[model samples]
Target: MTEPMTDLPCTARVPADVEAPDRILWGLTARQIAILAAAAAIAYLLWRAIGDRVPLAVTAAVLVPVAGAAAVLALGRRDGLPLDAWLLAAVRYRRRPRLAVPTEPVEPSGWGPVSERRPLPAVLRLPATAIDDDGSIAVPDTGSVALVVATTVNVDLRTGPEQAAIVGAYGRWLNSLTGPVQVVVSTQRVDLSSQATRIADAAHELPHPALADAALDYAAFLDELAEHRDPLGRTVTVACVAPAGARGEAVRRAEHTAASLTAVGCRSAVLDAATATAVVTAAVDPFAPTDASWPRTPPNDPVTAARSS
Candidate 1:
């Protein structure tokens, strides 16, 4: 006699090219078919126009290269994008402004010393205009977005039923999305210098000499590890975008996301304003130190020396 199965997890093999465009005909996507059709039509038109005047050999020589080039451009891909799109992007990148200043425009005074040689700066305009006190990032024309930091759940460590539950919960969250959502996983270098320093400092307070020595040794080990090897830390964040004038909705979505993720054996939370700002700052300049107080300093504000304590 066999015992009843306690748990059964439904599993499916997901293809690597799940996001690939569906093939419409002859193993070609709709876009590819359209491109090929256009290329063929252009070749036919050229042949009709010059077939009578030019020798068959010369016409074939001219049209063959052009048609081949068109076919390659239609079929080829570069850097994960279609060749045509890549070319267009390269062109746009070449044309884009190389230098930009803050969005704040200063009215030039006619009384100032004339410097005609210097070029005027172009304004740097980003989609996000401001971050609200409630952690909502405001976009000028689009909408507000709220961020939620989440921990990953290890499905391999869980039982079949547990894995199924985790997957189901995650799917529910994905299905409930009414607006654009972005999940960002980032890894950055970890600096253990502060921890080492703190441990070294507290080593004296351990009471026993053996414990103190052990703490000191551990601190020294951390310092050596930090100096010789590059340690890394990973963070996962979810950005929920809500339509304009719906900042509260974005926050609610973030909270909902956090709650859903919690059910999957993952720790998650909606970031506060300061934490959100810190996250953004870290993303923008990963190497920069950013322990600034709440309500971030304006980029255009003048720097003034503060009185020493």
Candidate 2:
């Protein structure tokens, strides 16, 4: 016995003659085989039902097993796997390692007890841009002002020659003004639904049905009257007077600008009606005239005490 060769169980090797089976009956994954089987069954059932004129019961019998297998496969494939799980896994797999080292923890100084450091409140940390209501970019304070409002005008439609004269006057006024002006036009639809509802309400409150109907009819007539009467068309022209300073020169410049605007068909007046009235009154007061020749006082003192008297 050549030193009696005893093979250790752990060290024993598989025999070369022993081989794994080349064909496995259940080698296909649960999903793959089920899908293939389902497709074949569906094809067979369709052919039998349509081509062979089989009854629905027989067709269903063939299809039910295929459908069941397909459902089971689909359910198994989806089981416990959320839509974002794969995406999250991929992101984690591809993430780069951070390069920085964490700071070492240190004991607090003996000034006071160590307090927990909490992060700032989210509201306080929000950017100023996020605080704006209109979501517009912040503008620097440039010290500019603007006033906007609607305007009304009474048109004089007397004669063609009158219109021509007015036009000529307007042209002169434009020649006189020194600054730019803006004109705005807008239209709005009047809502009659509220009126209709009111009429209906009144009709309902009438003592008799006939009276109620009559009242509703009257309301309808009123609504029609409002709708048909002079469909309101609006045009707004602004005579913007921007004076650099509130001093006498600014006032004179403003007046000159206004006169020029008036010559062009544009009516220019000081925004403050009272101030314009006072100036005009002072200029025209005959009793308070400083000189007999001119119907005006010094531009600086338009409203002198004598003129006021």
lDDT of 2 by residue, 1-309 (tens): 479544322221335633332332366544455566767777676766575677777777777777766555443433345223444565776673333223433545668765785332222221111101111112133111111223343335434454555556655655555554444344433334445556778788878999998988887875786678633334332433334332233234445545554544555453233333223343345234221111333224346464553
Worst 10 residues of 1 by lDDT: 289-298
Say which candidate scores most in TM-score.
1
Query: What RMSD value applies to candidate 1?
Result: 5.2
lDDT of each: 0.82, 0.45
Model 1 per-residue lDDT tens digits across residues 1-309: 999778786585445986788988989888888888888898899999999999999889979988888888889999999988899999998877777888765667888897674545678987777777788888778789999998887789888888788788888887888888999998876667777887999999999999999999999998999899988778899999899876499999899989988987789989877778777877887775332222344333355789999
Runs in model 2 lying further than 4 Å from the true structure = 1-160, 191-232, 239-309
* Residue 226 of model 1, lDDT score: 88
TM-score of each: 0.77, 0.24
Could you tell me how far off, in angstroms, the CA of residue 143 lies in candidate 1 after the best superposition? 1.5
Model 2: which ten-residue window has the lowest total lDDT? 126-135
